[model samples]
Target: MAGVGTVRSIISDSLGRSVMAEQPPKIVILTAPGEGLPDGLEALSGEAELLVAENGAQLRAALPGAQVLCVTDFRTNAISEAWSAADSLQWIHATSAGVDALLTAEVRESSIPVTNARGIFDRCIAEYVLGQIIAFCKDFAENQRLQQRHEWHHRETEPVTGRTVLVVGAGSIGRQIAQICGAMGMAVDGIGRGARPGDNDFGAIYAQADLISVLSDYDFVVIAAPLTPDTEGLFGAAEFQAMASSARLINIGRGPIVRTADLVSALQDGEIDGAALDVFEQEPLPAQHPLWDLPNVAISAHMAGDFIGWKRALSEQFITNYRRWAAGDALNNLVDKTHGFVPSTTNR
Candidate 1:
């Protein structure tokens, strides 16, 4: 509950301590109002200089002397400006689970170390995926629609128990989904870049090549993979056609990973039963978009992993990494420039 001035003083003190020890590094926060900083950072109050920017002008002004910039929104081009304006800037931390939006060509080419909120949204997103799957399986949407019409309808519903779920990209979030799904008695299958014996925590594991062959067997398919060169346009007409006519797909990963046009065609043709998508190729999904009117498709405003405590979770991750950095230790969750993140080598 510290005031803004108190937070500013704490930041100044932290920076002063670093400067006196010949390692001064200014910190700038790029987040919307009401997003609380981590508890650990309260101790840094009076130790580092902190500046909060809400708009382009304020953001640019705050960047001139910053050494680290923490970004919460990727909508602005201010990131590039900040990099150009601050010669001392060496690290960039994204407060979201995915860093795709902030991975601009300029930022990627720079030597600055970049990290993301990798593990923060795992449980939250898993629960969301689970809810969607159960809702779809139980025909909750249809029941709700009937209720609004004042029609009494009762029907037997399918259980998730013993059903199969195929999860693409067994990362932290994907593994969490698998675990929760398994707890509900659903068989879980995961596909990733490399499939080693006894490597996955999910019920079953397969390599990327097995995706098309196994598409027809699952009751639910969840795409939680990162957007990389190999994953762009990975799910298109052919993959959709390969799925069972009764299967549904859920995407909580990068938007472009699933082709919009192909998905539209599949939904129109009834190629697949339904879809619950939280991400899209174009955000705010234009008003004219056909996906909104599709009967079997459920579209969300990219908020599946966004929850009340998300900001605090993100800030806590930064604080933990900051402590490591201050102690002269290697940063955790380092992005692999070659592959976004090294799957096999890094600990999830």
Candidate 2:
């Protein structure tokens, strides 16, 4: 994987020095149809021949001599469908943190190295989780509603300090969330692929198997896990029922992680107090979706990790990694193809 982006062909110059062959490495930037290219991509213009592909046909055409593929449109499967045409493809990079959509069977089993924008989102998402927690604990939503109605009603709100927080997926993002929540005087524990104790960030790290057993104990439960096969639809009616009625949920993870219908039922039945959801099973959740009208649920498009100029940030990250690739250095944020994420231990 290290040499994938290195100039493969070499020749001797007049001075008897080794020089790269005349054929320059071609890099393909895969974007969604009609979407503008990522900012700062011009940084690579002098290093490699850059081509943009917005669909399968374009990707297939661009992959023949392409050594590197930068997938700005992480959600599309065009790459999987056009993989056979990747005759010279050595490395693939996804600008988005989640690579579930890109990890097709062929891509996962192949030796071609896969990387993701993992660290880029961790802190931004951590801040989002913290903001949502504060909003929920302080009942800011209710205050907004009361203000909208032009009524003055004084009420007591819950305090975040000293409350328990259970963060599922104790990876980099989860650890950052723990760091911030802990700073706010909250007791932070985590659930990950396996259980461990005395972790630097979490008080106790429990395995996924223990999630239900520990559900009722925490005042706040955050779904920060990746959307692997094991996590899709992980939280359903029973899981919701296991939660304390006073507890709130924050889902900045993939939408399918929680069953929408079951979640709605739980909220209506007081199975859980409230939820702050950024991602949903459906993008641009239907205008008539009940989740939108639910008083206890706060919803947003999947923008928790997207701040202003984030596209430029993502492009800059790729440029930094591209330099590493050219130098035969181990790329950062290398995804464990089998696991669909950069293992927490490996990337950090």
- In candidate 2, stretches whose alpha carbon ends up further than 4 angstroms from where it belongs are 1-20, 346-348
Highest lDDT model number: 2
Model 2 per-residue lDDT at 194: 86
**Model 1 ranges with Cα > 4 A deviation:** 1-24, 32-43, 54-61, 342-348
Candidate 2 residue-pair clash tally: 0
TM-scores, all models, native as reference: 0.85, 0.94
As for model 2, its CA RMSD to the true structure in angstroms is 3.3
- What's the lDDT for candidate 1? 0.79
**Candidate 2 local lDDT, 3-73, one digit each (tens):** 54555668898999998775657999999998756789988888789999999999998899788999988
lDDT for position 18 in model 2? 98
- Candidate 1: tens digits of C-alpha lDDT, residues 76-170: 56666555666666678877766765677877888988887887788889999999999998989898789999999878999889989999988
